[model samples]
Target: MTKLRIGIVGCGSITKYRHAPEYAHNDAVEIVAFCDPNVERATLMAEEYGGKVYADYLEMFHNEELDAVSVCTPNLYHAPISIAAARAGFHVLCEKPMAASEADALRMIAAAKDSGVILMVGHNQRLMPAHQKAKEVLLVGDLGKVLTFRTAFGHPGPESWSADGKESWFFQKDIAIVGAMGDLGVHKADLIRWLLDDEVVEISAFVETLHKEDTEVDDNAICIMRMGKGSIGTLTASWTYYKGEDNSTLLYCENGVIKIGTDPVDQVIVERTDGTIDKYDVGAMSTNTGQTHSGVIDSFIYSILTNTPPAITGEDGMKSLKVILAALESAASKTLVSIH
Candidate 1:
């Protein structure tokens, strides 16, 4: 079997903990090149993963023979690197918050379309075992129509998780675009949209730099959204949850409620109106502290090998990004923003 050749851009914490190790474990993939401005980081990854290190992604693209590339760079670089890879005829699996702006994301989609290569976004929340089970229950109509929902993703900031610690690009407005919203909020947005199988049509938000000092980007955000299917909800993303990580979602339905990630043993809990309850130990979610195989790499490889559309396509990413962008606008103007 001819293995799929992989090239990884950006040797940051995400690449180190998630992308590199996941790729290494896949028998179908051979990581051929690694690129990062910090040549030392790239070299270190190359030494572990058996790849040639390059300081520039463009140089790596020019030199290596790769079947796919993972765009694991800061939020700002997602567009350029993914676009370049697509144009070079390589499938791209880019990290979330797909690009700094919706326009750039559209261009990336166009590039992949023209190049006839797969372009997938790394929204691993949809692939979480709990989330998958929740979706399954919802699809069965056992919970009735979803009425209202609340989803939150909070952590004790990225300093401890990022490769650069306090100096990570996550705190830079220029690079990260938005702090908590981009880092954590976007994931929830994507997940909710998928879980409900609905789009957020309207949104009002309060996005502010509340806790972290010296960061231009927001540290917290709260968005009130109305889904196209008439379900209303609140999405909160925060970096000041000093207690521990909170990645949970609650869906209120016509017949009952479904809670996800609330219990340690039972990841998904379903409660019906008649006082019946069901618990599922679907498996653990991948957290910053307890990392697990995200299943994103496996799905991406499956799509390529089987010649199928990615589980999360670029269009799916753009729709989710629109929600975050709308939230930002709503924050600045202090008004509700509607997604078209």
Candidate 2:
């Protein structure tokens, strides 16, 4: 098959360090264009990635013969660009949290459906080997009836990962919409839902800017979630993890407890009530500085090439976004928010 002509619409740290380089390494993909309001950044990326630079993504979308595009821009621009790309006949690999709001995310999904294009979200946590193995184990009923779960994703701050560091769009409310909740929390929301195969029905949360100074968005969030029928969990996303990155999920089941990403050498561990411990080495989770193939870029390309719906479809993204939006509403209103 011919290489999938690709374009990326953001020159930020994620696009620069993660997305662009991965696409460059994929023999099945060809980087054809780069777009960012920051022309210098786009130009510099184009120089390295072999693409045309554009300050306006709309212009690039219309001009390039792209089979697909990655909407890696600031959170606010996600919906508009993804929608436009769908309408322009390009499959979309939009960076999560799908959009700034539920309405926008829904609109993006509708636009993709109407345009007959595949739309995928960049919730890569689901692609992690440990998480995948955990889901497989859960499906086989090895852990009888998941009772509850507690998951967390926290780091020093986006300043360390943002292309602009402290001044990155991640710290700006207008650009990022919500802070750690949107950035780190959405990943967990997508994760727990995928692992348990249950949607979050309600959420109560505390979203705050506890540590970061002069930030318009929250630096931390702790969410209590009601999943499907009866199972409950707590999701914590924080930018104040000064010690190191902590990304782990603990699922309490009737038969045993399953720990994922909680151990250094052992990535997935199952401790049964029968007094037996099972361990599986599924490799390490990808970090900002880690040099692992995110599987996301490859998966997106495979979906387009194989003419199959992406694993993380637009609707899946919408559901995850709904959870985050509901959590944000709950935090703002100081009440439990229901997801409809």
Candidate 3:
């Protein structure tokens, strides 16, 4: 069994906790190198993960005989790094929102297409076993026609992860792109789309900064979406939560309501027409999410070896990104925006 030689771009906290560790743990992956503008961080991660480090990812691409790389950089750097890696004949697993803009996202996709290498996105939410099962249930009509869905994803803020303590790129529009929407809301958009098996057709939103001072991006955002299949959905993301929680999704169907998350209540519930109720703790599924990234990395390696589309392709990421982008536009215009 040959291991896929992998490189990692950007040695940030996400890279440290998720991407690098996931790749390192995978039997089919050998992390060959790492890149970051901050050489010390990159070097530390590289040494810890058994890889060499470089300040420039392009140099790593040029020098290493790698089969793939994870672009775990800031939103602004996603395109260039993925494009370069793909052009250098390395499959790319880019961290999400795809890119800062649609044009850059498309370019990265095109590069991977031209290179004939796998272009996977780290929309890790869809990998949750409970979320995956929810998708299966919805697809099999266990929910009996989706009527409506609601989801929310947020954290306190990115200050804990950012190098700049309180003054972080998360607060700056130029570097961060958008705050809660891009950072956390995008995951909700992706999960909702995956579970509902539908594309968002229209959107209306409100985005605002409620707490953070001297920041250009919204700390809170709410978006209403009309899916192509006539299912309406609502997404809320914020950094204002007094307590920290992970993502969760809810759906109201003709048959029952499905709920998911770390909340102390039922994880999923089913109510039959005869008034009988079926409840699943879904606690184990939360444990499953712990291995989601590892599953993703193994799946990526499997896809490359088998010559199959990744579990989450660049197109999948793009569709999810479009929803978030549409939400942003709708929030800015204060109107329902068509998601064409």
Candidate 4:
């Protein structure tokens, strides 16, 4: 477990923003290779992150003795790249919206299982300090019972974050698959499932393309989910926030209400039935807002080194993907979809 060798595929905005910088600082990781279809981007990342650049990911995988790889490509490529990495004897840390479809996600899971390599999804919200605390509280039955909840993940649009701006692959439905719902919704799906400690049993949704001109994907989505134990929730993913990012969640229970990433100072706050308030300063999730770290890369490396299971397993990722796909199907058919 001495400085695990790593490779990064698809050197896009996520690589530059989270993976590269985070890996650069981690003492346990050595970024050994970088790959992207764009040679210039791959070369720049290699210069900064101390990795060999390659235009083809398969070539990088063949040449490097990588123990793990981060699949940061478009939604469609997630499955193929992850499956290939798993087969190549490298653990994979794939970005959210694990695949364009559930069938693809299941195939990725099967590949990882068959290859006997770790498969961790980059659902960083579950790694957030506030979120971790919330899960702890809920597991201890402090919330009494999560009867209903509402969570939202939104921002101006990919143009604000994408290196390619509006022309990014994220705007193309053929690649990104489901737009805002795929980009933002899947993260919430994973987080809420973990936080509530429940499975989504049903979904009804409205996945739409209402804003952001010249895009083949949706800009906003509203999904209603019925979870196990009769608990239910609303999930909103949007690229039309226009003003700023809103990655917040509110859980209403029999005894209290939990809020995370909602207020300025109190990052995690609990308000009881008697109006007593408890506030915690657990920091943030990503480096974008105020520089708190995501524990995704760290945990992925730990799992690989220790021969332990990752927090977000391939099956867990598939379950989250199922919710999103079901929502999209529900939107298209105008009916409540049952999660089998």
Supply candidate 3's per-residue lDDT for 1: 80
Q: How close is candidate 3 to the true structure, as a TM-score?
A: 0.94
- Winning candidate number (TM-score): 1
Tens-digit per-residue lDDT, 170-268, candidate 4: 898788888888889989999999997789999999999897888768899999999987989899999899878898999999999999889877888
User: Candidate 4: deviation at residue 210, Å?
Assistant: 0.9
**What local lDDT does model 2 show for residue 103?**
86
* Candidate 4, position 12, lDDT: 88
Model 1's alpha-carbon lDDT is 0.95
- lDDT per residue as tens, model 3, 280-322: 6644433212333446777888899899999998988988888
lDDT of each: 0.95, 0.91, 0.82, 0.89
Instruction: List the candidate 1 regions with Cα displacement exceeding 4 Å.
Output: none
- The regions of model 2 sitting more than 4 angstroms off are none
Q: For model 1, name the residue pairs that clash.
A: none
RMSD of each: 0.6, 1.0, 2.2, 1.3
- What TM-score number comes out for model 4? 0.97
Q: What tens digits encode model 1's per-residue C-alpha lDDT throughout 1-340?
A: 9999999999999999999999999999999999999999999999999989999899889889899999999999999999999999999999999999989999999999999999999999999999999999999997789999999999999999999999999998998998899899999999999999999999999999988999899999999999998999999999999999999999999999999999999999999999999999999989999999999999999999999999999999999999999999999999999998
